[model samples]
Structure formats: structure tokens, C-alpha cells
Target: MFLIPAIVLSQRPFLIPHPLLATAAPANASILLSGVLLSLVVIYLASKCGAEFSKRLDFPPVLGELVAGVVVGVSALHLVIFPESGMEASDSVVMTVLQWLNGLTPDALTNVFQSQSEVVSVLAELGVIILLFEIGLESDLRQLKEVGSQAVIVACVGVAVPFTAGTAGLMMLFNVPTIPAIFAGAALTATSIGITSKVLSELGRLKSKEGQIIVGAAIIDDVLGIIVLAVVASLAKTGEIDVTNVIYLIISATAFLIGSILLGSIFNKTFVTAVDKLKTRGNIVIPAFIFAFFMAFLGNAIHLEAILGAFAAGLVLDETDARNELDALVKPIADLLVPIFFVTVGARADLSVLNPALPENRAGLLIAVFLIAIAIVGKVVTGWAVFGQPGINRLAIGVGMIPRGEVGLVFAGIGSASGVLDKPLEAAIIIMVILTTFLAPPFLRVAFGQPEEPPANGEPSLEPAAVVNEA
Candidate 1:
């Protein structure tokens, strides 16, 4: 009778157990939730701040987003605090929720989350592809033609130097496998064209000779980066480097470029002709998106990056005629989706694990700093590639492409997924991403002549020139 009473007392709702009992929920779920919430809040605040800040500086709002992330991440404020004790508690809660949602066994929650992460990753990839396509649509091919040789030189120099520096730096510091080092090098090759373009536009130089060169070079850089990625991925899969395969990839990329332009030109002519004939009443955005997706799918079929397809599709659209409509259709989707992409990036950054105290960890941080320096120097060097143009600051143009942007993160994600990068290496890359992105805007404002304050007469002393090529 006494034992039964004790058992009944233990089962009582008000019964107090150990203090630790209150911490039984899993911590990872809490951490994830915190990260998500914090990221969203930071992005919102940063977006507002960026609008005003960007007027005085020559950079995109994404730079501000990166700065906001760094502030919340381990780099600065360390605000997204996750206690070690909370991990078990958070895990338990997450497991229970997962089991309830999918009828999964306790043992299966890990697998379920992994599966969910994969799905999210695929969608993120799709988002990037669409983003790239939109960029291509906004691209001016005529500018590329005009800047052809100079752009080629700038891109080649830009890619080669940083890639070599990154690979060598990793090999010396980490002693990692050759393949992983190669991937690391490849990751350094990207230039966030969006950020560069935004800065150029802000400086009222987007139509200048230097601006055209930077833009053209950025497009080529994307092409080169994708080709390198394909080769690295193929090597990762095969575990052996095949010279013939690498050659084939290059050839295939070349073919894709030529073919895409030819096909896109024909398609653009036909589509615009149809739009004219049909006088379609509804918005053409859906059709445009469909075409973008179609091109993305085609690129995937060819083992090319889906973004290439989106870009080709964009190139096909007669931007001169359809610019306003296309912009209206795409901008809304971009506005909604792009922030999610950046915030997701911040949320996914596992900065809590990074320890700068340990030698290996310190090495990783140093590697990040070294790579950033290399990235900056490499682009600056490309400015010297401009010949017979003394007035044009090729250095400024090259420097403009230093920020790695979304594509760099995408590369890091691929490396992380492929096991080419361990957690520390991944963390290091994230730091590099944040640093390059955050530094560009302010520096770019200085590099490009800053816009003077408006005159009292309501007209600025210097008027922004219309779209004109500087000889």
C-alpha cells in the first residue's frame, strides 16, 4: 500500500524531479529554430538599412545581408547562442515531432532530417539556377562582343591566380587530399556579378567602358566556373582524374555556349514574332518563367549547370522590347525568394563549432583570410590586362569582381556535400564569403567616384551620362 502511494505520487503532474529533467528536450531543434528566426530578423533589418546605406555606398544590399549574418554568427556578436546541454533536449523534441509528423520511429528521425535537408538543397539549387537565368536576361550581349578580348583576358587571369593561391594555401595549411584542394581552388573562382553590377549602377558607370568589360568578364567567369565545377565533380565521382574527360568538358561547354547563343537567337526571334502576332492579353511572365525552367532543364540534361540554361533563355528574350514586362514579372518573385535564399545561407552557417584557439582551427581562419587577399589581389591584377586604354581603370574593373556572392556559397555547399570540405574548412569558406561580400561595397564606393551631394538648385553638378561607350 505504501509502495503504491509512492508510485502514484511520482506520477503526479506537480511532482518535482531533478532540475535537469526540465532540460530533456533536444537542443538542435531549438538551435535550428533560433537560427531561422534570427536570420529572418537580421535580413529584414539589413534590407532596410541597406536601402539607405547603398545610396552613399556603391554596393548591393546583399553585402549588407552578409554583414548582418556575420554580426549574428560567431564572427562578431555570437548572438545565436546554443548551449551544449540544450542539444539533448532539442534533439528529443525534434525527434518526437518528426516521429509524429511522418510516423517515423525514434531511430529514423536522423534519416528523415537528412532527407528533408536534401530536398531543401535541391530547391536552393533551383533557386540559384533561376537567379542566374534572371541575371542573363538582364545581360547585354552586345556589350560582351565589344569587350570580348579584354574580358577574356581579365576573366582568365582572374580565375587562374586565385585558384592557384587557394589550392596552394589549402595544401600547405591543411594537408588535405589533392581533390579537395582542387575543389577549394574552384570555389575561389566565382565573382558575384550581381554585387558588382549593383555597385557599377550606383556609381553611374554601368554603361562605361570599364563597366562593360567587368560585366562581360563576369559572364565569362560564370561559364569558366561551371566548366571547372563539372570537371571537379566528375573527378570526385570517379576518384581518378581523366585528362580526356576534362578536355571533353571544356569542349562541351564551348559547344553549349555557341549552341545556346544560336538557338537563343532563333528562339527569341520566333517568340517575339509570336508575341507580336498573338497580342497576348495576359501577363507574359508565366511563359517567360516556363521558358527559363525549360532552359534550366535542358542545361541539366547536357550535364551543364541549370543556371546556364536560364541564362540562355534570358539571352533569347528581346530585352529591348520586353524589358519592362519581364522585369515586372520577375522582380516580384525575386524579391520574395532571394531574401529567403540569403537567410537560409545564414541559418545554415554552423559557426558555433568553429574554434580559433586550436591550431587547425586557426589555420582554417588564416586560410580564409589568405584566400580573401588572393581573391582581391587576383582581380586587381586583371586590371593590368587592359591594353591601349590609359584613362580606363582596369584595376577598378577587376577589383569590382572580387566578391564571390551566391555562387561562392553554392560552391562551398557542393564541397561540403561531397565531403571535400570538413566542417572547419566549410566554416572557413563561409567566413571568406562574408568578408569578401561585406568589404566590396564600401571599397567600391571609393574606387568609383562617389556621387556628390545634390545642389540646392535640385540639379547635381555632374549629370549621369546616358548609355554610351567610352572609347
Candidate 2:
């Protein structure tokens, strides 16, 4: 039996001798495969580590993932090493082996990794859209009606203050032209509602009065963020911020929003009614995915982020009982896809260009610090925007909004791509991203009075805060 097994193994295709033993081609192919496999392994292991870290630290898992990337990337540890001269020499044979794997069809390896990166990016974009949509779905529009004025005031102030501080800081510190600074500051105006919501939920104050105000303000913040982004993008392309164009963008955005809501409401009724009539078997997920992609595509056609459409779709679903079922279905996919978004953001962050020795680099770092300070302080002040209410801690609500997470990084990416920020500035923006995300959870836990120990007898000890029902 042993002899037969040996013979079978020897005869396998994988065990066959290389026909081109003398060529460099085979060695290169081997190298490429190693890199791809190594990247995958790293991602999986990092995700596991990230989950544990988040639980232990009481922070968002994204912070853990960023740490994981720092370990693998050149920014910190040189775990994923690629040697020059096309010759691999390292203490451990693993680096050599990875180099050999990467050598195999270098072009093919490059193409494969690029495609994989793009796939992850598309999913990440989808995840953001879904996240925003979930927020909209969960939103109480009636609450907005009650505190609309307050929300608008807080959001406007929040956007303006941070933006001005960020722009001025960038311009003075980096000595960059005015246009880029304006764009950079504009990027900082948007609040990442996901991070804010996560912190609020952890604080056991998701239904609090201040929480409601923050949520309302965030919706306005997002709208303003898009407008600023559009204006900046136009300026980047045209080399001047046109007042006429800005006016047009504002009008267009308003129409797009109103149109999306109206159209979404009508489509929601029609589609849900049809689905009810069809009495579909199994899960509604596949159809739902199709519908989501279609709406995302439509949003793109309208010159808006597909996420806007996804958010609209979610709002429509929120009006129906099917929202719960859809959430259940989508949560699994979100779990698998969302981490890729965070990790990819980290992967794309190339910090090597930021040499602290250089004056420009040092200046950029200072600007980053200043802007981050403003970003945090500005939102914290907005907590006071919850007016006509007493006995509520507005500071907690503002603190909850401190983290920028994916959205802020997305804006930084836009600036980098549009030539509004150099590599070092981008690195600085990422630092701010990491800081805000890492800090929020612990602060939230403290603010909300989370007990240090589990309640005895497994009884729920904490009581929900009094609901500040303005509506």
C-alpha cells in the first residue's frame, strides 16, 4: 500500500518535473503565487485579531484592522517584504518563497492583484452605501421635523468651522496654494455617521435627546459634505471655483435629493407590492441585491455616488415590514465585505513619502494635527446645539461624532487623486483617521456609564435613558 501511494503521488501533475528548468520564467511565476497567498492569509489572520482587539479595547474593529495593515505594510513592520535585484535573501525562507511566487508571470500577478483590489473596492463602496442607507432607514423623519432648525444650525456650524480651520491650517503650514487647502478642509466637513452611531449605541444612549440631535445634524452634514465635495472637485478640474457652477451644483443636488425621495417612495410601494403578489420562495436577498445594484447604477447616472441611491433604496424599505428581513439578509454580506473596505483603505495608504526630516513634511504633519484638533473640537461644540432640552449631556453626543473612519479617508483619497494633497498630507489625514477611530469607543464607554463588571445573576442593570421625544 505504501509503494502504491508513493507511485500515485509521484505521478500527480503537481509533482511533474519542470520542462523549462533553466529559465527565469518558472521562478517568477512561483513568486507571484506566494504573494497573493500571503496577502490572503494576512487579511484573514488580521481580521480575526482585529475582532478580538476591538472586543478587548471596546473600540471599532476598523482600528484593529488598521493596526494589522501597519504590521504587514511598509509603514511599520516589513512583514510583506519584496527585495530588489529580483533575488530574495532573508533570514526566514518565507520571504524568499514569496518572492519566488511573485516571480511567476510578474504581469499576470500584477493583473490578478489589481483585479482583486478593484473587486474589494467596489464592495467597499457598496458597503458604505448600505451603511448610509441603513442609517436613513432607521432615521425618524418626524424627529427631524421637530428639531430641524437646531440640526441645520449645528450641522452648518460644524461644517463651516472645521472647514475653515482645516483650510487655513493647511495653507499656512504646507505653503500650498489656496485651492488645495479649501478642498482639504471641505473633505473634513463630513461626519461619519457610522462611527458616531456605533459610539452612541455603545454608550446606551442611542435613543437619548442629544443622540437624536446628532443624528439629525449628521444627515444635514452629509448633504453639505456632498456639496462641498462637488464644489471642490469642480474647482480642482477647472482651476477656479465658479460661483455659477456652485449655484448649479446646489440646485442640482437639491433636486436630486427631492427626486430621489419621491421616486424611492413610489418605487418602494410598487416593488414591495409586486414582491408580495409574487409570494417568492426562499430568500428575498438575491432580488434585493439586484435591486440595490440597479439603484446604485441609477445614482451614478445621475452624477451622484451610488451610495446616495442605496441610501434612498434603504429609506424606501424602512417604510415597509420587509426592512427587518432585508437587514437580516444583508448583515451577513456586510460582515464579509465591510472589513475588506477598511483593510483596503489601509493598504492604499502609502506613508513612505512622508519624511519627517523635510520642512514641508513637518509642516504638513503640524497641519494634520491642527485640523484633527479642529475636527474633534468642532463636533464636540455641536453637542451644545441640542437646545430646548435639559438634563442631557451634549458633550457626549459631540464626542461620539469625533471619529471620521472610512468617509474621512475617502475624502482624503479624493484630495490625493485630484492633486489637492501630496503624499505626506495624505499620510497625515490617515493619522487623523486612525486617531479619531481609536479614541471614540473608550471615551463613549466612560461617558455612558458602562459598568466595569457584569451584573450579578445576569440581570440587566442599566436602565434606558429618558426619551426626549420632541416630535
Candidate 3:
């Protein structure tokens, strides 16, 4: 499995007169595959260990995965370092291992390094698509409908307040540049439905009036957050906001989501018929993914984020008779792919920017402090947005929306990839995500009067948080 470099080196003289060209050819492909496999090994170990430790501590497993990634990433071990961070193949522990094992030439090592990074990045992207799809499945449209206007008010306020307040404060108070400020502000908009829902379930309040409002608003918040992310991510790429592009994204995202859900009945019928006719395995799930990938492709093709399409696909399928079965089938796939997404997000973060010793790093530390304040206070105030609930626990509704969770990480990752966020700013966004995610569960428990320990009955776990790499 690892002899490709040896085979190539031994045959190089006969195959080509130019050593450099020969080294850059198919040799890197073989090594790239090896590097990716080793990277996955490290990623899985970190994810599982981190998740297991976090679970024991009563924290979200996703937090452990992020911290674990930081430990193995450029922030510490340098075991899974990337090329974009100005690191060479020699900087990566994985690459060093491969070199020692295969006796790679310097030229071949560089090629393998770049190729390996690209492939891992692609896998991380796929992991997010799967994560969004699973989120869609969990966002029950029926529940969303039943919850009504109060939830809508809460969700709108949750998105608008933080976005407006965070962006303006960064620009006005901190003198930060516009695009980066917008990206950071956009990161604050997402409320992790998965994490909040899990907490509500654990507290036995998933059926409470307040619980229903929180869940419903969070569902709406996810949709709005994706739209906001799509717009800001596009703007980040261009480094300037184009009004036309923003309007187009907003309209297209809204239209795509509404269109797909509207047509869901017709699609669901065809989907069921196809699944029933197939005697082979993956009958239902296969068709579901084809639709998902197709929607994701359309989203990208239309200049929107691919996740929007994947999300819309999930919503459409959520209405089907096969919803529960599809949810069960999709979980294992999500488990395999989603950790790669979370770990990579964690790995890319450079925590060194948060250090207070350096004069330059203080700005980042302050930004992080500012963002955390905005993240909590902005969402917490959304509780007051709930009108006509007479005696509703408005504080609980707001607290539930506070955790940015996996969804916030998605924003930071995209912003970093777009190169609009400087290291300091990017690190600040990550810190805010981590703090808000960690704080939400306990704050929620207190807000709800610290409900009893979850019952021992084997009732199907309402903790969908575990499914999405959040809780």
C-alpha cells in the first residue's frame, strides 16, 4: 500500500529524463491517498476522544472535537497542519511520517502536501453538506407550523438584533473594516437548533409552551442564518458588498427553499414509489442523496452556497412518509462525515492570536470579548420579543438561542477560506463560537429552573444534538 514512491523512484530514470517533472507526476497521487488516510486516522481519534471526554463532563461533544483538533493542529502538535497557513511539508507531522516511511524526494513531498490538503478540505466541505442535510431532517415543518407567530417574531429578532448590533459595533467602536465586520456579525446570527433542542428534551420541556416557541424559532433562525451566511460569504470572497449580488442571493435562497418545500408532495410520492419498487439496498436513502447532491449542485451553480441546496433538500424530504426511516439511515453517514467538518474547522483556528502577551494579539482578545457579549446578549434579548405569551419563560427562549454551535463554525470556516478574515478576526469568531456553545446548555438549564435528570425510560432520545456533532 505504501510502495508507490519506491516504485516510482526506482523507475524514474527509465520513465523520464527530467527528475522534477517525474517527481510531480502520478507519484504524488499515491502519496496523497496515503496522507489522506493517515489524516483521517488522526481526525477520528481526536473526534472520538474529544467527544467522549466532553460527554463525561456534561459539555457538548462538539466542543471536545474542536479542542482536540486544536491540540493536533497548528496550534499545538502540528500533526494535521495545512499549507495555506504558510507551513511546508516539513512542518506537518503527518507529512514527516509519510516521508520517513516512503523516502520521498523534496519535490514529491511538496506535491503530496498540496494535494493532501486539497482533498481533506474537500472532505470537510462534504461533511458540512451532510451536517446541514441532517439538520433539515430534524427541523419539523409541522412543528414549525403549529408554533405560529410568536416563534416567528422570536426568530426574526434573534437574527436581526445581533447582526445589526454586532456589525455596527465592530465598525463604529473598534474601527474594523466593513467586510470582516459583516462576516463576524453574520456569524452571530445562527442559533444552533440541535444543541438547544437537546437541552429542552433533557429538561423534559420539549413539549412545554416555551420549549415549542424556542424550537420553532430556532428552526426559522437556521433558515435565516443560512441565507445570511450565503450573502456574507459571497461578499467576503469579493471583499466588497455588491448590492445586486446580495439581493440576488436573498431572493434565490428564499425562492429555492420555498420552491422545494412547495413541490415536496409531488416529489415525496415519486420518492416513495421508487423506494417501494427497489428490492436492493439503499433504496430510499440513495434517492434521497441523489436529490440532495443535485440540489447542492444547483445551489453552487447559482452562486449561492451549496449548503443552502442541501438544507432545502432536507426540508423537502422532512415532509415525506419516509422521514423517520430516512433520519435513521442518514445518521451513520453523518457520523462518518460530520466529524471531519468539525475537526477541520477546529484545526484551522489559530488560537495564538488570542494571547494577551503580544501587543498585536490584544485586539483579537478584545474582539473576542466583544463578540461573546454580543452573542449572548443579542440572543438573550430575543426572549423579550415573544409577545402574548402572558407568563412564558421569555428568558428560557432567549437563552436557548444563544449557542451558535456547528452553524456558527460554518460561518467562521467559510470566512477564513475566503481570506477576508485576518488571523486575529478569524480567531475571535472561533472563540465566540466556542464560548457561546459551551455557555448555552447550562444557562438554559438555569433559566428553566434546573429540571430533573432525564428519565431512565428508553424513550427515543430527543437529543438530536448528538446526531449533528453539536451536543
Which candidate number would show the highest lDDT if scored against the true structure?
3
Per residue, candidate 2 scores C-alpha lDDT tens digits across 1-471 of 000011122222212333221332454435434544565566557666865676577654555665665565445544432221112234223354543544534444443333333333445555666655554555554564577777778788788888888888777866768887787687667776655654453444554566667766775676677667767866877876667755765575567656766676677776676667765573466666666767666665645555555655665666666766766566656556555544544544445535677765775577668767877887778777667767877777677667666566656656676677776666677667666666765666666565234357897433111111100
Model 2 poorest ten-residue lDDT run: 1-10
The residue-by-residue lDDT of candidate 3 on 5-97, one tens digit each, is 111121211112322323456766677789999999999999999879976787556667777888888789988877656588899999999
Sort by lDDT, best first: what order?
Answer: 3, 1, 2
Which one wins on TM-score?
A: 3
TM-score of 2: 0.74
Per-residue lDDT tens digits for candidate 1, residues 357-435, read 7666776686677777877887788888887677887657867878786566666766676677886676677667666
TM-scores for the candidates: 0.71, 0.74, 0.79
Candidate 3 residues lying further than 4 Å off, grouped into runs, are 1-24, 148-151, 175-187, 190-241, 388-393, 403-430, 437-471
RMSD of each: 12.9, 11.7, 8.2
10 residues in a row with least lDDT, candidate 3: 1-10
